[model samples]
Target: MTVALLETAWLVPLYPLLAALLSLAWSPGLISRTGPRPCGYLNLLMVSAAFVHSVVALTALHTNARAGAEALYRPITFGWTWLDTAGLRIGFDGLITEPALVAMTVITGLHVLVQLYSIAYLEMDWGWPRFFGSLSFFEAGLCALVLTDSLFFSYVILELLTFGTYLIVGTWYNQPLVVKGARDAFLTKRIGDLILLAGVIALLPLTGTWNFHGLQGWAADQINNHNTLPPAITLILLALIAGPMGKCAQIPLHLWLDEAMESPLPSTVLRNSVVVVGGAWVLLRLEPLIELSPLVQTVLVIVGGTSALVGSLIALAQIDVKRALSFLVSSWLGLLFVAVGLGGIDVADHLMLVYPLAMALMLMAVGAIVLTNITQDLTQLGGLWSKRPLMGLAFLTGAAGLMALPPFGGFAALRELLELTAASSSPAVLGGVVLITNALISAGLIRVFGLIWAGRPSVFTTRSPEVLWLMALPTFVLMGLMLHLPQLLVINGVFSLSPLPGWGPQALPLLLSTLVGGGLSAVFYLRPHPLAHLPAALGGLQDWLAHDMQTERFYHRTVVWLVVSLARLSAWSDDRLIDGFSGASGSAAMAGARRLSLTTSGRSQLYALTLVLGVVLMAIWLLATPAAAPELVRPFS
Candidate 1:
């Protein structure tokens, strides 16, 4: 029965898919009498089933592993012909492996939790069908993404996810900010999606297959054989990373995640947790190909390092609590990129596994606070610890799970990453990058906690109460999962049990970094600080970081401006060059035709008489001129 579930794993996505499609009926009032609640409930049920299905499949796979059944544990590939033509065939392929099942479990499980929470969160919302449907759609896309074996199909799934993001973020279409957020996010992500598609299309021709296993083999053969990669192939490999760069919210394409917070918090929970990791998921798969080029790996390190440091810094400056968290999501994913760059896929895997649960837990706790107090601005919130101790504890758990605190999943993951970077080419320089980024991340997390729950009550926090039970339930459940995650890591042998809990060769430095950063932030925000920096001292710097280091402005003056200018130029050229040339040619032709038509008098008799007279005149001229009519003139002489 367990093996059968694995065989039918593809059906998991379809459940939520069908729910999303059926939800359309609600929007059109086909089910108005029952209200939009049914659509939400239906999607919730579908997601829950997918979660259970994934759990069972995962358990079965592990059961097989423990039983020493190699065949059952081996990746089982199943696919149907999607497109088959002359020398062209695309298959809807799926691979059921332990990792894929684990990802499915996380994705669907998060969806179920978010759906349950959304019920009370968006209780009075009229756009329930659209909201719930987009959520279901996201689950379906992510589930299929992890399951699919083909890079081409993964790109397809990512495109679907990009569209789903736009829909979900624009759930409150009535709000102008939401509309702008949706549009920016869609366009920004599309830039990466389009480039990644180019890489995907270009890849099949060079490597001869889109399957992950095939690509892995091909890349390994090329590298082991010591073959030099063509410059174009290297470019293609770099292009492949672009999608993940955008999806993971790294560097220049990073701001989309911040703005996407215009959506409701329930969707924000999933977006921050599972959805942002979507790109990293694809990047991990492409690590083998990326490993082939030193230049590409260097590019990854630079981008990853820059984003890690900068994103954390920006998070520290953000007053909007959601934006702060979103930027940190970018920061954490940057570490994953660095791992992939350094050829530390195992460490990257550990980071990927822990990030979603921790981020989700934090978002849910914050969501509860934001829902109750009615503000996402840090300046407008304070002293919530007394009012909502359960949530405060939950928030602390989430923060601990995220930071390099002892015994949490995050400590194990970072320790592994630190070891990897320390063994790299520039150990001191690169390892320092990892340490500094973690410190900033640690500082940022505690800074958030201090602002919201540690200080004196603000107007917004004075009357704040505990959120509804539905929201509280998921927050605590995730908190429990976060605590159990370290043990699970040991059980699965991703990390062996440390001699002291979460302690190792790298533990001291990582823990020290966490403490120094968090301790300093605690002093500034948590301890009734008259020790804070003066506004004049931090004036320009604070504004710059708070405004995302003025990235949007920089983009406006650069990328956005270039795009808008080119668009205007294209429109002008169409009107002036293309249209003018065609119009001038048409006018010239018409004028020539008009003059020719005027020369014809429209009288057949006059035309005939003129022709005869012209011929007679020609004859007379020939007769009068001796050279013209030599034979006729000889008789006259």
Candidate 2:
């Protein structure tokens, strides 16, 4: 029975996709009488079905493993060939087993929560069909991405997600910022997609397969045979890493996520939680291949570490509430990247597992506040804890889950990451990076919490009421999940013991950092104080970090300028060279035709007179020039 379910796991993604298609029936004119609310419910039903199947499959896999049916625990892969030509083959192969199913369960579960959350969040909006359809499509794409075992197809699904983000982000097409955000998101991700495609094409000939399992085996064999990838192929590996780097919103490619906040909050919830991590999921699969090149590994560490550190700093400077949360997403994922670079796969997986719930809860809490107040500026919100106790509790729970405090999901995962980093040669430095990142994250979250829920009442929060039951229910549900994550981990043996007893020299730095960060934030902003402004001397620097370290401006002067310049050059060449040549030829043809038209009279007498005059002129020229006449006669002879 377990085998049968595993074999049919492909149906999981298809379920949501079918729901997406069904949503079209609710489009404006197709079913105008039924209204758009029903579309949301339809999509919800589809996601719930997928969630149910995912749960069944996960339970079956776990049961088989516990029963010692090790053979049944093996990855059950089956799919038809998708493409075949010239001795190359790509297929839709899937691995239905533990980690993949586990990812699917999280993704589908989040989809269910997000759909319910959106129903209430968007209750007043008239764009339900497009909104819900995009959600279903995103769910399907992410689910397929997790279940598929092929690197080639992973890129394909990622591209789909990129397009889906464009659609979802631009849902309110009337808004200029929304359109711009959507365009930026699409173009930025496209750059990564193209680079990844190049890497995939280059990789297939070398590895001779695209399947993750096959590639892993081949990579292992190459290492065992003492055959290392050459310099050129190592560069290809670097190119491959860029795809995930951009997808995961690492430095340089990280600007898209910030701009994407112009999207609806529900979409932001999923993007922040799972969609952004899709790149990292692919990276985890390609970890073996990336580890082959030390240069690539170092690159990953540098990118991840730098992004983590800088992203946290930038988060502190952000006044826009969503951007604060957005930067933290990059920061945490940055830690995951560092783990992968340090060859800590288990730690990275642990990070991914613990991240979504907490992040979703926080974002949902933020959304609830924003909905009630119609504002996201931290400075404009305060003293809502009394009226909206549930949101405050939800936010605090999320904040705890995210920070390195005791008994929370983040603490264990971060402690384990700290342990992993401690074993490295530069433990002090790498471990400090983790500690500092945690501290800054703690400070950032606390700062927001104080500004929004602590101080005296501001205009925005003066009369704030709790959000609708739809939104609040999901927030509480996910909050419960975040709160229970550590317990669940312990029960499953994922965490061996209580977190406090595991504290040692390795955990000391993380603990101190979180405490210091949290303490500083509480002291400065926890009361009715000025809205936490940077000092006068730090004006320039504060603005820099607040503006995403001016990364967008830097790109404008460099990448954006270069691309725009090249585009202008191309346009100029087409206008001057190609268009000029065509225009000149056209002008000359028209001139000759006009001159010919002057000779063509509508009367036969005019034609005869012109011919007679031409003959008489020729006769006169022949008589005057006998030498020219001889040349003309020679041709005739």
Please give each candidate's TM-score: 0.94, 0.92
Q: Rate the local accuracy (lDDT) of all candidates.
A: 0.88, 0.88
Report the lDDT tens digits of candidate 1 across residue range 1-637.
8878866777889989998998999977888888888888998998899999989877777775542253255567789988999888899788877788889999998888899899999988888999999999999999999989899999999999999999999998989999999999999898888889999999998999999989999999997899877789988988899999999999988988988999999999999999999899999999988988888999999999999999998998888989999999998999999999999998899899989999999999999999989899998888888898888788889889889988888988898889888889988988888889888988898888988999899999999876778887877888899888888887878777757444677888999999998888888989668654447876789888889888889989999899999999999999999999999999999999999888887899989999999999999999998874556445654
Per-residue lDDT tens digits of candidate 2, residues 306-420?
9999999999999899999999999999999999999999989989888988999999999999998999999899888788878989999999988998778788788888998
- Give the number of the best model, judged by lDDT: 1
Model 2 spans > 4 angstroms off: 1-3, 65-73, 498-505, 529-531, 593-637
Candidate 2 accuracy as lDDT: 0.88
State, as a TM-score between 0 and 1, how close model 2 is to the true structure.
Answer: 0.92
- Measured on C-alpha atoms, candidate 1 has an lDDT of 0.88
State the TM-score for model 1: 0.94
* Superposed Cα deviation of residue 552, candidate 1 (Å): 1.1
